[model samples]
Target: MAESGAPTQRESMADRIYQALKEDIFEFRLIPGDKFSESDIAQRLSASRTPVREALYRLEREGYVDVLFRSGWQIRQLDFKQIEELYDLRITLERAAMHKICRLDKPPPALRLLNDIWNPDAPSERAFGSTVRALDESFHCELVAAADNDEMTQVHQRITDRLRIVRRLDFTRPDRIDATYREHAEILQALIANNPGEAAEKMTAHIRTSQEAVKGISLERIREVSQQHRRREPGRP
Candidate 1:
């Protein structure tokens, strides 16, 4: 029992480290191109080197970081061209899903759930900040799932995961937040009405708008956010 429990505890520690590191990346506390050693991370997080290494390998696989040959791990830089290509792929897959969704004999139950969240009757009932960003991700994912293609859904989810860091930056402004609510409501209405053409157009435009917003993000922008974040939490390095 002791031996069995030990591995679980180690795994839990790795998971915690993974979450912490991911938060640092997302909040720009660890800016792109930043490099640090496993020992440094373990010391900063007060964790064991073994778990820190495990967590970093996982982040590397997820495209968040890369291992250097003789040096330490470095945060992955944002590739604008690759990001643009990914956005195009996402649009293609989602547009196809929209057509399939419209052709379904029965409406997907998830549509109702999406409608409730996105098409709320009053502004007072809406979610805010990071919550809205998460919901926005789920909204597109649910639409893909509604098309009833497990393979496509899986691919879409992978793209969504890869895009999350840059994509979430779109929600930082009040105007973007308002646009998201309005655009999501429009897309939801189109989907609910079983109008594939309209839904596809709205989804394409919505994603394009978000893509455009993230394009304005520069290294300086990340540095500014990191400075603000470090100021708020003085302990972060």
Candidate 2:
């Protein structure tokens, strides 16, 4: 039911809050398990509580945050199990994309776009990581487009969106960023050579190695955060 004077579909406010929160979370400005208050966000953004609440609801639905019983909202923590699932899903979709890329006689524009962003001469780790992340996303998207599977692409995109925060965290580590670029080069070479099997293998290995490297972070830290958020009441000291 439309409100007496409200528009049927409001576009911008929810999106503004979404983008703002997403950037903060991805850049680690909002640490995992950090508590958030709807009132605080609403005040800071100079928006009504309704839109801020809407944004928080959407974030929670997307697995980026969890709504505690009495507490406000908490950023979701990363876990090995979720990381493993992300890699497994990527392997499946990426292999399909590799096959499609190899079958084509000429490279698609998407592949070219990926190559441009992944240039090896990038100066800073932050810039390099940003490029790599973009390229990584473009590669998978190109694969889906090449396969001409809209439904699967949507599904993959949804999963990727859920993993964005963790992926950003993984890439921010200096050593991981370097290793990621090296792996990207190898993967690109395999794609250029039209070796679907080799490309898939390299992609899978890259994801696995990255996951293994970050496995050392204490899951206890994540658990502690989750517990704290769960216990804290909204507006409490």
Taken over the whole model, the C-alpha lDDT of each candidate is: 0.87, 0.71
lDDT of 2 by residue, 56-130 (tens): 889888778898887788988776687678768877887787787788878766666666656566645335567
- Tens-place lDDT digits, model 1, residues 1-237: 024555444448889899899888877778888989999999998988999999999999878899998789999998888789889999999999999998999999988888888774778888889898888888899889999999999999878877887886678888888898899889888988889999999999999999998998877777887788889888656
Clashing pairs in 2: none
Model 1 ranges with Cα > 4 A deviation: 1-11
Clashing residue pairs for model 1: none
Q: Which window of ten consecutive residues has the lowest lDDT sum in model 2?
A: 228-237
Best by TM-score: 1
Candidate 2 positional error at 190, Å: 3.0
